[model samples]
Target: MLSAVSRALLGALMLSVAAVAAQAQDFPNRPITIVLPYPPGASTEQVARMIQPVMQERLKQPVVIENKPGGNGSIGTLAVARSAPDGHTILLTTNALMTIVPHVQTMPFDPLKDFVPLTTAIRGILGIAVNPNVPAKNVAEFVAYAKANPKKVHFGTAGIGSPQHMAGLLLNREAGIDLVHVPYKGGGPAVNDAMGGHIQAVIATVSSVIGQHKSGLLRIIGIGEKERFAGQPDIQAIAETVPGFEATSWLAFYAPAGTPKAAVDVLNRELVFALNTPEVKQKLFDLGLPVVADKPEELDRRTRSDLKLWGDIAREMNVRAE
Candidate 1:
């Protein structure tokens, strides 16, 4: 009972739906690669390696992890953003790259618009640690020492506009101290310098410096959390002394925008399932990454929220990347 043109439109719509369904069913015809936008041994890389095995088993495809570190994680992220939307290339990176860096540096792609968030792999607690030679036992002592020395206290971070950098900036604002920030290529190098006394202190993820702290090479003075993190209870919260100080970082999975919804669902399901497993959770915890397997929407919301938060912080502190 329909006109010829109307009938043809209906048929075309049905065919499009069928094609998408077929694409979903035939997804992952080839291997999938997770692009890690950070150097090896970073928390993001470590988290990706932890989930790679389980995800491979679930998807029944050979999963490969590729490390492409640069531009504060934008280099590899741009690669994934420009990749085909066939779900073969996934990006595993931190909030800083998506939320913080864009505000400071010109990005090749829109983070929120160019990528579909799959899931948040884990959240890490940031902490402030001092070299053994520095005279600081806790947040209060460190603040006093920094104030007394002024620019003499240098704090190393992963890089400019990184969560570590933001944490140091916030500490300066709240504690009224002047700790010069020394940006490094990555957290590993910063921690190494802190241990070697090349820098007086470092604001980094707890996991990145925990080993050195345990070995007595670097002394962790304060945890950048509202309360003491359950993972490391012995460390006192920086907020306890500074009042309302907190900073944390998260790593997440993302695929190029326009990837099939079916593929996104599958990846999210497998990732959430793998992270919920006790073995995987414990392993992540061992590396100072607490499991935070949330739905894709949750990651999206967090990304948007953090973008604003870091943007404001960067603007207030006049922090920019060149």
Candidate 2:
């Protein structure tokens, strides 16, 4: 006969084991929907398309990717939060949706608790690209020029609360310069405006700026990564000049809270397999994504850390809703 306290502890352990087994059994029986907060052509959308077939094959159900491109990604993200916890619907989005936008606006759901972490779907490096005729040739020169001419160097972004906008703001803070932010509807338009020489600079994803850099339409000043990119070894990271400076655009998958542990595990296993494929890896590399795959726990840690990081930045920089 066991003591009362020991009996209760033993019963709790059994219940926990039973719960784990039960969750693993009833997951992923139907179609899954991946909600993309950005438009179809965005990097996060592209990654969703890349992994769908792989996930479908593993889960034995078609994965549908739905585009909900508005409100700087809060609208779509909130939809996922309010969705059922059946594991059939997941929000696939960048850090901006969870970490940046909420600091600047009123959101419908809590970023920390409303969702279950699935995985970090992808990670991309940021690059500061400017028009060909900009006076600055490198990051140092660009900073100096912007310092000398405050509010004259026009920096365009997708919009306020966007990663690009935050990147611009972070750059301004680090460089101690004031560059006018020219917001656009999307990254494509922002890059177009920069290429047209309407804006002096744009902090965009490496993939978006690489082709233009190759075509001589824009000049690649520096990347916001720890090292040089494999595709473009000529351009160095911005951190080379500004120590402790690094910014990235990453996509992750999240299910509504209370999603079965089985479903999360299945999805995480399938996603990890998809990310390791040769074709997927090559495409991500070509697109300037660093191709980092994380476990659900790691993603949770990252999301929490980044939320605090960006939240602090938003407060310090006085970034407000547009």
Candidate 3:
């Protein structure tokens, strides 16, 4: 019933509409890959697996996790920043990789310009744990002991610019005590030394000491989180005695710059849903992490605020990469 020219025009418009609809519908046709800057078997990798299933269920596509660890997480982080802006790839990393690394090292990519945040994955508190042989039983006791002993109270950390190191510096500044800082290659080594009584204390994630603490091999003196963890109700918060002292580590999901808004939105919605699941929550809790599932704008704001805060901390302490 239509002439050739009219039919051609109608066909072109229909095709355009169909193309847009198809793009929207076929959003996750392929598997999605989440790149982590930490090695396998670490807390970050463990948490990634815990949530991957829930994300897959919500998105109806397989979510794969990749480990590309090195250079204090700078190597894999730069890889993610250079990745395609498509929704297929995502970076699951700690704030240290973005916020602390730039201040510590000469980076290959810009954190602010190279990526857009999708959502905050989790925030974990660091606990001050010590060998059971140490005399301190609480934060105040530890401060008093350290102050009395001075540099005799040796502490270990993952590395110089690591969150562990920053936490130690903050503790020194707040408690007005001088303690020797012994930097190790990673948390594993630092924790091992502490377990062997080679180190007096170490500021580390709760997950890193849950087993040892349960076995009485180590003592958790205080937590950085506002409230006590359900499993460790007996331990008091460091802030209770330190007065205004707190340090927490955060992990987030990010997409490379120029990623489509529709794609970012789709991923963000799925992540929020995935994090809200009971199974995901329990898994994170088991690892001593709390899910944050923030909106994109909220994540953006948090990132900027963290940058400013850490910048101040770095300047105040004169922390430099080694």
Candidate 4:
């Protein structure tokens, strides 16, 4: 008893539903490429490589890591954004690039709208370290020293608008001290400069500075995370001295928006399984990214939470990439 027009629309809707089911059933019909938007050999890249084999085995597809490093992780991110949402292509990215930097830089694709998070598998920890030559031993002591020396106490970060930069700026604003910031091409170079005494302090990954901290080359005065890292319990959290302080970054997997929910669920299952693998878990810890492996919904919730937190920090602090 339906009208002809209504019958045609119903048929189209049924066909669309069937097509989605078929697509999900045939997911990863070919190879799966994880686009890493950072340079090779960085922790982000290392994480992708570490999980590649496990995912390949579980998904029964050739999982390849395509490095598309540039524009502070935007060039490759955009490429994935524009890719087919058939679950064949995914982006392995961070909170800094997704939530923090987006507030300051105009992007070709909307981060919050263009991607669907699969899961958050790991998080990066940041630390504040100073040259052994610096007299400060703890964050409180360091703040006092910075207040006395003013711009004389220079701090280096991986780059402008990076998580390290955010951490440094928060310290400056809260402690009411002027710690001159020197941006570097990478965290390694920033930490190296601090080690050589070219800069008084450097904000970088806890993993990057841990060896030097143990070697007596530099001292980790405080950790940017709310609590101390499990591996390094001796280091003090910055919040111990500066109330409510935390600057951390998490790496999550995402597919272009409109990717089928079934495909996303499949990818999330495999991604979480890969991360929890004993070998992958130990390596990630060694690399200084503690395993999170949260659900897709949790990843989405965390992203929204960080957008509000870091967005406020970036705006109030006037942090910008350009």
Candidate 5:
């Protein structure tokens, strides 16, 4: 009787392993959805659109993009979390939604817990841009102007929990000036508002406003990286003025937690292939984003590290949502 019980347990374990393997093999039998947490025209959406065709061709299944914008990207992120772990649904979002937003607002899903980071697609630095009509030409001038105007100078961002929002907050503290925060549903609108002179400044992904910056519609005075962007060295680093200020962000891909290992592997392999394509690389470079195309483990490590770093910073800054 003892031997029979042991044999039965072994059989059960074997069945479980076989079931998981089968699930992985059959993954993406249906259409795959890549959920965009923000509205159309954001950098995240552009990234998704760039890779969708390649992914579909490689996976041999239709991949659709779904936009669900609100709650600083928590709503769409949570939808992916609650989805089946069969790898049919994925998420394309910025690191801010994972690292900074959760610290400011009560997130419906835990970014680190509820999703598996597939890979980092592209990396870009945050930039500070103002309308051409603004008198400030650089970070120092901007700070002095803000000091004189105090809370009247309105600064906009993609959203309250965005990396831009945190960068703006840190600028206010480090520069010893007050600039009111304005949260937009997406980066596209915020940049537009700045170009239209409705807002005094905006901290956004360089990709979103580089075209306008070159056209004189908006002037990018400072980048939030520790050093100036190599592609556009004319703009000084915000750190040069504020000291120790940085807000680098990445566009990453994710699947729901508990997804089959095989499925995750397939997605990672194909998506990396798509990002490495020459056409895609050129487009990203033109938009001021450097192709990261890192492995799944790399993204996992970054997500964990950034989560801790941003969480502490959020608390120290006492950053509240808009």
Candidate 6:
């Protein structure tokens, strides 16, 4: 016993709910695209490619990887942020986009509000490597050398305000050193300069310089992770010397903010399943990225925490992208 208008409103609401449920059931009816906000050879891109097949199989749709590198990862990230909130287009990017860049540069979208956290796909530790000519074999010796030399020691990073740059800033504050930062176009150039002895030190990912370290071209002075990386147990964690030093870079999956909760849940389930597969885990581990199939809330918490951490560091260091 309801008025005509009230009955019509109820019917319309029911229809809307049914439509959303149907859409969720047929989630990803079209091919899904994962936008990598960095160049192709980056660790994020590599990890995306590795997970692509498994995700496709799980979702029953082709998963495409699209690279759109520019503006320190903001260009492509903004594209994903502006995409339809239908789960068809998603972003697979690093913490730098949400945690570091926004603090240093003006972004088109709000990092916290424009996207929904899906999962943290993988995490990799940074390495404190030095040119072989430097007389530092450990974190203590390296810190001592840097302190003794002051601004004479140059530390090369991927770019200004990058995670590597933040790591350098943290190192200076925690270890009490005055090493100068030399910004490079990317980690490749920075690593190359360190290898060629153009720079005394470089903070880079383990995958970027592990081969060189093994070949004796460069020496890994310390690991920037709280615990030792499983792939390289012999390398000691920098925290042992610096007392609570830990900096890591991670790649995470996110969808547009208004994507249906059902769609988000499906994507998270498929992604977590893919990450837990033995072969996928093995491949990621081989590449120095440990699989971290954390729940959505976990990633969200981490992202928010890192945003504050890097924001404070940026203000203190007066870091801005060049």
The segments of candidate 6 whose C-alpha lies over 4 angstroms from its true place after superposition are none
- lDDT value, residue 255 of candidate 1: 95
| Best lDDT among the predictions, by candidate number | 6
Tens-digit lDDT string for candidate 6 (199-270): 999999888889999999999988888988879998889999999998998899999999999999989998
For residues 105-166, could you state the per-residue lDDT of candidate 4 as single tens digits? 88777877999999997888999999998999999999999999988999999888888898
Write one digit per residue (lDDT tens) for candidate 2, span 1-322.
9999999999999999887677568577678899988777877778888888887887788999999978667778889998988788999888988888889888878888899999997777788999989987888998888888988999888788788888888888777889899888778898999999989888888888889999999998998887777788999888888777778878888999998877888878888899888899889888888677889999999999989888998999788886
Residue 178: error of model 5 in Å? 3.4
lDDT of 3: 0.85
TM-score, candidate 3, is 0.89
RMSD of each: 2.0, 3.3, 4.1, 1.4, 2.7, 1.1
Ranking by TM-score: 6, 4, 1, 2, 3, 5
Q: Against the hidden true structure, what lDDT does model 6 obtain?
A: 0.90
Question: What overall lDDT, based on C-alpha atoms, would model 4 receive against the true structure?
Answer: 0.89
Error of 5 at 34 (Å): 1.7
Error of 5 at 167 (Å): 1.0
Question: For each candidate, what TM-score against the reference?
Answer: 0.92, 0.90, 0.89, 0.96, 0.87, 0.97
Global lDDT of each model?
0.89, 0.85, 0.85, 0.89, 0.87, 0.90
Report the lDDT tens digits of candidate 1 across residue range 1-322: 9999999999999999999898899877789999998778777777777778887887788999999988667789899999999888999888888898898888888989999999998888899999999978888889888889998899999889889999999889989998899999778899989999999999998987898899999999888778887888999999999998878898899999999889999888888998888888998888778898999999999999989888998999899996
lDDT assessment of candidate 2: 0.85
Considering every candidate listed, which one attains the maximal TM-score?
6
Better-scoring candidate (lDDT), 1 or 5: 1
Residue 187 error for model 5, in Å? Answer: 3.8
Measured by TM-score, how close is model 1 to the native structure? 0.92
| Per-residue accuracy of model 3 over 1-322 as CA lDDT, tens digit each | 9999999999999999787668756887789999988888876787688878888887888999999998778788888888877778889888887787677767788878999989998887789899999988888889989989988998998888777788888888888998889999888898999999999998888888888988998999998877777857888988899888888788899998877778889999988888878988877877888788999999999889878877788889777887
